[model samples]
Target: MTGRTPAPSDRTSRRRRAGVVVPHQPTRLQRLLARLVFLLIRAVALTLRRSLVDRTGCHDPLPPRAIYAVWHNRLALCLEAYRTYARPRSAARGLAALVSASRDGGFLAAVLECYGVRPVRGSSSRRGPQALLELTTWAERGYDLAITPDGPRGPRYVVQDGVISLAQVTGLPIVPASYRLSRFLRLRSWDGFIVPLPFARWEVILGKPLHVPRQVSETEREEFRRELQRRLLEITQD
Candidate 1:
């Protein structure tokens, strides 16, 4: 044999091993279900003033091209709130989210797509590098990027470095955001997933935008992460 390496028999297999395969396309039924869910969320959010809080910045009038950082536990309610508040602000600019690379994230991606939210599937602990790269590209393309600072098998409410890294790389301000519900069911899951009961009073809070230097020190990174965690907790705390 020559010194050159032999090519893989299947491109698909090679791609899978390299973690570069295309995501699965949802079926028609799946798409329909996703659409139904999206519509229901929008309807519910629109109907209840108490069920949603939308505290945005003056930056809303200007196109939204920043990074939105939220906690994992408040995901469900936050999704609806974003659709109501942030959607209109960023509709023209486009919005993309960093989802987990796990199978569960596949379903989540489909759901997001139904709401016109593009999913850049990856997580801080899984496929993180690729996800960060994708997010940077999306941000450079003027898409508002959203990330759950504590997500995808979280330590529950703790912020990871990925979000900070993303902001630094994309040169986008990190907007700390969260939601609080007067009545909701909290899942026993790792992140204590929260689901707001219909008609429940909700408060969506947005902290001032935070910026990270592209060449921050490790200490600075950790400090920023801690600040983000504290801000999310302050908004979501009962």
Candidate 2:
């Protein structure tokens, strides 16, 4: 089953149907902070040497597209890594990431724009199902999707149902990815967020793709979610 294209004929109409609210516009201070974060990511990414782990056993090059899953805490580095290594072969507009539809997500949306990644606003907590549907539409429209499953808020490293549902709907394989840094700082955030220092070696893994059966029972969905979480943990040691 291929993913469905969004019902709305145009992007603006789709936004209205989702009942999406425009997040507060960034203040001057917010813009400055976004710039700083943007530069920080660039510098750190430049200093690190990286690699991709294909747990799925396919020896060919990275797939032209995938639903790349990473943890909430690793969002920053993962975005840059994707840009440097995975963005080229994707559709010209690049990867479409699922971001929360909230004030906080506004900040992230801006940073993503800086790096040329497109941010699709919505989350499991707000406009939740609609976001999933939109993501499926994006995947069908040829944009590789990126998701932080335990994100927007988390039970830390625990996978959510949304991603599994997405795979079922999109017929796209889930690629679990994570990175380990030789040196880093773990912020006291809910996910023990890591900010890798410059010059630290960053080793990334793109786990073998896990294909979700389109018509799974609830138990199967949970099982797949846990399996994804387990795969991510396998490559996250730092």
Candidate 3:
């Protein structure tokens, strides 16, 4: 049951494809606010002491490409985490993150731009299929992919199937990553989003990569999903 890669035409005509809503473009005001937020977060992140524990072995020199599966709650410092640990070792030009295709997503997309990372809009809902195709295009162009297995909305730390599907189609390994902050606050969001305080110690843990075979059955995909969930939970600490 090998998943077929979407055809080149699928990549070329993705936006025009039926059922794909055009992603919301951020207005000028939103872009300005995003820059202010980015600067504020950058100042805080720079004050934190950070370290990486790479169980993946790929960190001696990161793989040319692999999907990073970070939990939704741990996203506050994810972009910085990439800049700290993955980017230096990554042979790829840059990273691309899957974001929601809503008005809120527009603001976040602008923030990603400030970090020089590409934002691929769409989620498990909204323009899902189109987003997947667009992500595949990014992968083909040599950008590493990042996804929150449970995100936009969540059942907390549960792993969703979309990451598995992306790996199947793109033939990239999935690397489960999590971080522990010595000081932090949990927001009242569905995922209990973590906001790390400045000047705290941060430990980013990268688990061994999980390779999803192109010919996986649905049952096997579920098994991979659970394995990812377990690894993420295992390495995470409050």
Which candidate achieves the best lDDT against the true structure? Answer: 3
Q: In model 2, what is the error at residue 3, expressed in angstroms?
A: 44
lDDT of each: 0.76, 0.80, 0.89
Model 3 ranges with Cα > 4 A deviation: 1-18
RMSD of each: 4.2, 7.7, 7.8
| Candidate 1 ranges beyond 4 A from true positions | 1-12, 19-32, 51-64, 89-92
Instruction: Find the 10 residues in a row with the least total lDDT in model 1.
Output: 51-60
Estimate, for each residue in 154-180, the C-alpha lDDT of model 3 and write its tens digit: 898999889999999999889899999
Give a tens-digit lDDT track for model 1, residues 173-211: 887888777777888888778766778777777776788
The candidate with the higher TM-score, 1 or 2, is 2
Candidate 1 lDDT at 159 equals 88
Q: Which pairs, if any, clash in model 2?
A: 55-208, 56-208
lDDT of 1: 0.76
Report the error of model 1 at residue 208, Å: 1.8
* 2 or 3, greater by TM-score: 3
